[model samples]
Target: MSLCFFDYGYSLLLRHTTEEAIATCIEAIEPARAALTSQLRNTVINDLIEGLTKHDWFTELDIADEPPPVRFSLREWINQAKEVQATVFIAEKQEALVKESWEVLKQNIPENSLRFFTLVLEIAPAVKNMFSFLKDSDEIPQNNPKLKAHAVKVFKMTCESAIQLRQKGEVVVSDTTLKYLGSVHVEKGVIDPHFQVVKEALMRTVKEAVGDQKWSDEMGSAWGEAYDQLAAAIKTEMKQQLEAAPKSSSD
Candidate 1:
């Protein structure tokens, strides 16, 4: 089941219940005359009437006049994709953290290996925002073919990213393990040091190769710039709100 279906079904159910409850309340108003204040009764009736009359009030609800269903569905798809991607990312990071600990604990570990491991850890927190847009979707993509395509793209990117990360992880582990092995001149530490590098590299490598299609350096830079703009706007708005706050009695 997709997250979209779940959200839409839940919303529809809420709307239906609200309508039923309003009807029941209105019908019971005569019997329980004092249950609702006069203003409350008027407000409830007006809202119910407006909801009931909305369709009739609109003479033409053509496709152009209505919200684009495609855009709505696409947004839903993106949300679901982001949620699942985020889960994958956090899980990967957890595994990497364990690997990092192992590498740090192991004897004769080189600083070069530490550098790669640290680089891998640095990106985990950065990718946390990627999942903000994704939500659990239960809606099947039948209503929108574009959403289906987007789902396919997201899945493909995930798989590709996983494979590439695995390959790179192997390379990093092999290189680091050989260094550690040469330094210790022992065989027992091979598993600890090598596997740690492999695991951590695997987690960090995918920030570029996986998740969203446009998460490359260029796109990432643009996103950072946009985030700065958004933060500045929010700060300004907050400052304005503070300035407009009611003056204290001391004033």
Candidate 2:
């Protein structure tokens, strides 16, 4: 009878332990699962809008066929830019959503900070695209000087981050440079002389773009290597920026 009673007691203890473990798991997962759902919506905005902006359907603003340069309608172009800008604004509004989601995630899975940060990193490229969209907006040039300045600020920030990340081994330098080059192809098509000019100009500006920083000898050599490829790829973008920079209609 004592042996049977002891066996029953052990079973009860095991059952209690199992129940507690299950409860702990459910508590941990509930908030994280909810946060993941919210993050899904954020991703929809950042990724979807970015893909729309970066699409290669970027035809030259010149649409007429008669002679020298075709005259695309400024009104129509500006209207399109307004629509895109609205989308970006909508995405920006979701900043609160991202914060809430991250809070839940952090509370539930504190150990996953780096993973969450990396997930946030996924939106970095999309953020860059949003800035590029703003930069390419004819609306800013025609109607809003303030917005044009904001767009340039965003572009500068992205360029700075890309350069720093490349140097620190925090991100892929070549890929970031390529993305910048691709953005430059908006007004300037992938044609010959223009493309070559832009690429060269981008290379020349890298050091200035990144700002002056102290690096060890090893880092300096690594930076030199990274700079070589980026210098070649960024020429097209640099030339395009120079052409666009001074021609704001807000002048």
lDDT of 1 by residue, 95-201 (tens): 34333333332332232333333343343333222222222333222334444444344333322333233222321223343343333322222223333343445
Candidate 2 local lDDT, residue 57: 66
Number of the top-ranking candidate, with lDDT as the measure: 2
**Tens-digit lDDT track for model 2 on 1-251?**
44345446556655776877756655565445545544655566566556546655643477557668766454445455567667545433333332332333334332232222223223332322334434454332323444445434433433343344432234334566555665655444434544233233333333232334622333333434443444444554556565666664673
lDDT of 1 at 98: 35
Q: List residue ranges in candidate 1 displaced over 4 A.
A: 1-214
> What is the total number of backbone clashes in candidate 2?
5
TM-score for all models, in order of appearance? 0.18, 0.20
Q: All models: lDDT?
A: 0.38, 0.43
Q: Give the Å shift of residue 236 in candidate 1.
A: 0.8
Best model number under TM-score: 2
